[model samples]
Target: MTTFLTGWGRTAPTPAVLTRPRSVEELCELIGAAPGRGVVARGLGRSYGDAAQNAGGLVLDCTGLDGWTFDEGSGLVTASGGVSLHELMTALVPRGWFVPVSPGTRHVTVGGAVAADVHGKNHHRDSSFGAHVRSLTLVTADGTARTLRPGDPLFQATVGGMGLTGVIAEATFGCVPIETSLMRVDVERTADLDETLATMAATDDRYRYTVAWIDLLAQGRRMGRSVLTRGDHAARTDEKEPPAFAPGALVRAPAWAPGGLLNGLSVRAFNEVWYRKAPRRRTIVQGIAPFFHPLDFVDGWNRMYGSRGFVQYQFVVPFGAEETLRGIVGALSAHGTVSFLTVLKRFGPGSGGLLSFPMPGWTLALDIPVGQRGLAGLLRGFDRRVAEAGGRVYLAKDSRLHADMMAAMYPELERWRQIREQADPAGLFRSDLARRLRL
Candidate 1:
């Protein structure tokens, strides 16, 4: 059927021939005889941009392939590409097992996680999602199914290859062992950017997961005030048992909202109230959902940005590139970019997924409505600065990045291209992101 698809950000909606195949064999047949527009695979479509979108092409909706098997002894789970992390956790957590990593939301599918090489708050301690992946079952351009391990060049290519390597069929990954479903969390309100960074640097190792919610609208004396939260799984005790499963959506957004619902004035007010509500210093136990995936609680919350949609700009710079980070933050504040969901994280190391987005350094993500005035030119300028500073933008969250800056941001893009070409010389796997970035 012809369908209009967009990423979680709701930007760059495009029409495509969408089909769902029940098994790997059916998918292979579809790819083998795909139309001239080419074929690409899609999961839950959590990527904020066109990574999962293919314009006027065959987009394989892989969710129909969802299946899973778990081994309690080894804490390893083998699941189909279409199975979401939410599904895995829903079943595993109650059985005393948890996904090794959890991103901002659990709505992402296993295939999507491997393709994007997602990272979570625990990134400072654990590596990316690819690091825990044991193997992958892939259907490549030649319509052949192959099992790949970590050491293979194609394996690295497929991990963060953004689904360009092939359509993932199933994957095996190790899960973490958790005694309880609650997180012992510590929160601190920072006065400014310096304190926030300093505090994170000084005490980040004490916790397994950490992140800071920044107030970008604040300028001058308070340019990066933040609410820093860090936590680790609680040990079993005589205390009451925490909720074994994450909570589902509580309320859905209205059918429609005004385009200016998240303008500078509204965003500033929200940020002010959010920042003030957080305590100066507090330590408490919280549910897993509230601690890790708070946004999931509000159904279709992206619509709050309104019909114009939103742009999620995520970039990372090396540890020594503090000046560049400060400059970007200052520019955003100066422009009064309307972003209430701004986040800052410290990444530990790259997982060597040729096109993967994280490394040992600092990364910041912002959600700005598409209709913001001069937002394009402003972001383009930031792109140049990021490339010059030896930084890279996250492809999973990118939409407007130009082809010229891709190689600069990701030094291994050429290597990734070589591997992807070898895997699919006929260019069977394609997406709007690949076309836009000339990948």
Candidate 2:
């Protein structure tokens, strides 16, 4: 059957033949019979853009391969591509273990995480999901299953390859041991962008996880006002009860919303309240759900942007490019971009994946509702500026980036393409993103 699919941002819905492969054998069989447009794996569909949408092609829904094992003594977990972080955390937290890294949302599959090399607040300390991967099994176009480990060329190509290298069948990765599911958090509000950067750079090393919520709509003296939240897992003594990992969305957005629901005026109001509500400074203990995955508390929150959808732009600049970061923020504020969710974080280092997004620097992500005036031109300018600053945008969250900027942002693109070609000479793996960016 032809199924229509879109990324979490709800943009560019495309049609494809979606299939669920129950095992490695089934996956290989499906790949062998892929249509002319080729095949790409789809997990929980949390990627904000077209990285997983294979228009008019075969879309393998790998969730059927959900199975995992944990070697508690070694803190290693061997999980099939379909297993979600939510599932893993629910099971592991009670047993005193947790995924080495987690993005803003836990609804992503193990394969999806590896494919995007997803990073989290702890990136300043632990790098990305790819860094934790011990090994991964990839089913090539020729039905050859190869288990590649770190330091292998093929492994680097597959990690952060955006599901274009091949379908991630299964993987084994190291997990972190946790004494409890709660987090000990500290909150601080920064008066401006410079203060925010200084505070984080000076003290981020003290915490395992840190992030800042910036009010992109602020201007002049108040431009870049932000709330910084940093935390680490709480010890058993911090919580009276045993660790528990049950989490669920507190509410769901309406299926239908007005296109202009998140306009400049409304988002500005929301940003003001959000900024003011965060205490100037405070220390508290929070449940895992609120600390790391607060957005997960609302199901289908993407719909809040309304039917026209939204665009997520994420980019990272090297440590010395603070001026570039400030200029971009100032531009967005001056333009009244109406981005309700703007986040800033410090990344320690890249995971060494050929196309991994992070580098030892600062990263910022913004969620802007589509159809804003001059949105395309403004973002395109940002692309040029980012590339010029030796920074790269996150492919997993991108939608509007042009192909010409790919080489400028990622110098290793050619090497990654070569390895991808060698693994699947017939080019049996493809996606709409691959077509758009010519990856």
Question: What are the lDDT scores of the predictions, listed in order?
Answer: 0.91, 0.94
Please list the Cα RMSD from the true structure of every candidate, rounded to 1 decimal place: 1.0, 0.7
| Best of the candidates, lDDT | 2
lDDT of 1 by residue, 296-321 (tens): 98988999989879999999998999
Considering every candidate listed, which one attains the maximal TM-score? Answer: 2
Off by over 4 Å in 2: none
Cα lDDT, model 1, residue 257: 92
Q: Assess the local accuracy of residue 267 in candidate 2 as a C-alpha lDDT between 0 and 100.
A: 88
Query: Candidate 1 regions off by >4 Å?
Result: none
What shift in Å separates residue 374 of candidate 1 from its native position after superposition? 1.6
Pairs clashing within candidate 2: none
lDDT, candidate 2, 234-330, per-residue tens: 9988997888999999999898989999888998899889989999999999999899898899888999999889999999999899999999999
Measured by TM-score, how close is model 2 to the native structure? 0.99
**TM-score per candidate:** 0.98, 0.99
Candidate 1 residue pairs in clash (backbone atoms < 3 Å): none
Could you tell me the lDDT of residue 241 within candidate 1?
A: 74
